[model samples]
Target: MKSTIAFLLTLTATLLSHLPTPSDAFVYPKTPISNTVWKPEQDVTISWHDDKHAPLLSSSPIFDIFLMTGADDKQKKLATIASNVDGGTTTSVKYHVPHVSPPGQIYFLMFQTKDGSGMAWATRFTITDSEGNPGTLRPVIPEGGTINPGGIGAIISSSAKHRKSSAAAAKPAAAFADRTATAAGAHAPVKAANAPAASVGGGNTQEENVVVGGASSHKESSALKASAGGLMAVAAVVVISGLQFLGF
Candidate 1:
């Protein structure tokens, strides 16, 4: 009896192996999660568009939210919400983010079917203030300022101050040029006084040399002419004395 029972169990195991394993029946949606943002400390009501997913997902499919923390796609169960599908009607669902999640921490939201065998989707986001939001849909600063601390108003103020300073720097330099020209003009007389001393000293020295040479030349010429006239008179007197001594 024991041998017969063992033979029957072996036959059943072999037959089951030959048969095909049942495939998973659920279909996953390919709709992307859009309009993602972050809110610090406050309850982050995370939501996404689910209208396109109505056809693939069950009419009342239950959602399982998973946050992929660290490596290996390890799922950290976060929250779950029910999908709204009313005969092809479009709708959305929300999941509240934990307040303890610090700023700039990477997190992923994975929407999966309850059976864990349907088409799964995941989108990444970071917790941050509005100004400091990361990822593709980051917050935009205002026209004149930056995000103040974490809001749009601070951004506007920062931008305004930046523009004001830039405008002041960009003003025309004409006024500065005029002031420089005026200062240069005022110093022109001082420059002339410092320059003329060397020129005047050279001119006076040359004039003194010319005057001394002229006076010395005039005195030497007059002395030479007087000596020549005295020699002629002495010669005439000597000749008259010789004639008288000879009694001729």
Candidate 2:
């Protein structure tokens, strides 16, 4: 009886060890294949498969999806595709791609459980512009570092150029105003000086006329005095001749 009981217990232990556990659960991405290509502002579908042992509705009912780039060691998260998704009922989700800067071919999708228990990554894919041209990814710039002149950098450069052109156009107008103000200031003094000079010239002319008039009056008075003296002498001579004839 004891040996049979020990044998039954050993059989039960062996069966229980082979059963699936929470650690054995896994999610597999399916939609983003190697040849898949997406465009900005396009609505795309992403799908995945979960193992039977996965806690789809129990421990992890919600999932999160993300767009990723680079290798596993240096992977970078580009954007969040979906969040709080029901993993038990649906295996696919739709996402609208935004206008991402620096479009490239080194993109992939990652599906993760809400509890961070299990995750899966899709194959590499491509993202192109409206013209179907493959673009380079923007390089990761460190803090306080300069960005390369492309993608977002190109947009910033264009904006800076526009501001510079506006400032350049304003410079000529400012300089012209300054020159006008200076010309006005210089001419104002000249006008004031000319007015005073004209008044002084008129005063000097009046003084000169007064001096000439006084000299002419003095000469006329002297000539009149000499004429009167001559008249008196002629009258005295005529009287003396009359007296000698009458002998009075």
Decoy 1 TM-score against native = 0.31
lDDT of 2 by residue, 1-248 (tens): 45654554555443333222234235666777756788755678887776554564444356656665443222344556776666666677777755432344455655555554555557556665544555544232235422111111011122333242223222221122211111111111011111111010100100000000000111122332333344345444555554555563
Say which candidate scores most in lDDT: 2
1-248 per-residue lDDT for model 1 (tens digits): 45644554455443333221112122232222223444532344433344333324435444333332211111232323233222223234333343212223233434444433332333334544333443222222234431111111111122333233222222232211221111111111111212111110100100000000000111122322333334344444454454454453
- Residue 208, model 1: lDDT of 7
For model 1, give the RMSD to the true fold. Answer: 54.7
lDDT (Cα atoms) of all candidates against the true structure: 0.28, 0.42
Q: What is the C-alpha RMSD of each candidate to the true structure, in Å?
A: 54.7, 55.3
Candidate 1 whole-model C-alpha lDDT, 0 to 1 = 0.28
Candidate 2 similarity to native, TM-score:
0.43
Give the C-alpha miss distance for residue 59 in model 1, angstroms: 4.7
Clashes of each: 11, 0
